[model samples]
Target: MNLILFTVVATIGYATAQSEQYTDRYDSLRIDDVLANKRLTAAYIKCMLEKGKCTAEGRELKSHITEALQNGCSKCTQKQLAGVKKVIKHLINKENAYWVELTDMYDPKKEYRHKYERELKSL
Candidate 1:
């Protein structure tokens, strides 16, 4: 388990500094409020989460990243899905990983809320 722990720590360390863009507040709104904003890119959101500069939880950051994928991406194949999930697992807390992993099972025909029902309910 030492290697696994080391990998996790290394990943976390790499993500600790995203962009210098974030100031104390954005238009009087907290960082969490702006996370799901349509204008932000997935990369930017991922960086923000990695930096962990704001008070937003790991789950919240993953939610926003998933939301961005939903909005910006077309239907993803299994391979694409796996990559998104891999990123989520590395980015969020282990406790929140299950929920994000469950989200990877998304079907384009189904709504986002319906897709993650089990994970959400369990939480």
Candidate 2:
């Protein structure tokens, strides 16, 4: 009876570990999906920044990406990193352009808009 109980406990522990590993793998795959989709990546980051959901330091983004890569079933390659950078750059450019347009449409009397325009131009 003692041996049987030990075997059952060991089996359960192994299964639990396997389940957690699978979950991690799934999350990594999801991250890869996001990274692979340029439009999705741009939209996600832009929305996060615009909504103030993201920090200015970009630490969260970097950590999330690193974690995903670390837990990923397959390690990320240089090509993947380059692709992510391109997507981020594209999103930043788009956001800058949007700010510029908003600035152009703002009334000169609005000090806030004028300041925002200057900031966008600087970016």
Candidate 3:
């Protein structure tokens, strides 16, 4: 990893700023189901990469990805954070290519990749 429109995590939550934190509309998404479905995962990946059409959730996610990654997702709700962590873990361990692609896109300067990597390893 630069910029991850495919912050896959972004697609999972896609929160909007309302009050002090991000909205919780997508907080109840089933991340496990998404991860287990290759087609769904591919769709998200394509969306993130700007190679395919985005679902509403994907569009929302893409909008906030840079801000979310740069700011450590400070606005995310707890459930969204948990889902993000899970998705990051999956990206790091199983989908390294996508992870790299996302990182390269979102963290082009390598600003947040190492930080996230260390954090994920610790978890």
Q: Each prediction's Cα lDDT score?
A: 0.42, 0.45, 0.84
Tens-digit lDDT string for candidate 3 (4-63): 755755655654334657667777778999999989998998899898999887887788
The residue ranges of model 1 lying beyond 4 angstroms of the native Cα positions read: 1-46, 50-68, 71-78, 86-93, 97-114, 117-123
Model 2's C-alpha root-mean-square deviation from the true structure amounts to 13.6
Q: Pick the candidate with the highest lDDT.
A: 3
- The list of candidate 3 runs beyond 4 A from truth reads 1-18
Clashing pairs in model 2, backbone N/Cα/C closer than 3 A: none
Task: Please name the candidate that would achieve the greatest TM-score relative to the true structure.
Answer: 3
Q: List model 1 lDDT by residue over 1-123, tens digit each.
A: 999999999887766542311222222333333334434434344444453233443343444455545653233334434444443433343334433434444334445635345333444
lDDT of 3: 0.84
Q: Model 2, residue 77: what's the lDDT?
A: 46
Note the residue pairs that clash in candidate 1.
none
Q: Rank the candidates by lDDT, best first.
A: 3, 2, 1
> On residues 33-118, what C-alpha lDDT tens digit does candidate 2 reach at each position?
76567666555555433532443323344444434333432333444444444543443355555343333333234444444334
Q: Lowest-lDDT window of 10 residues in candidate 2?
A: 20-29
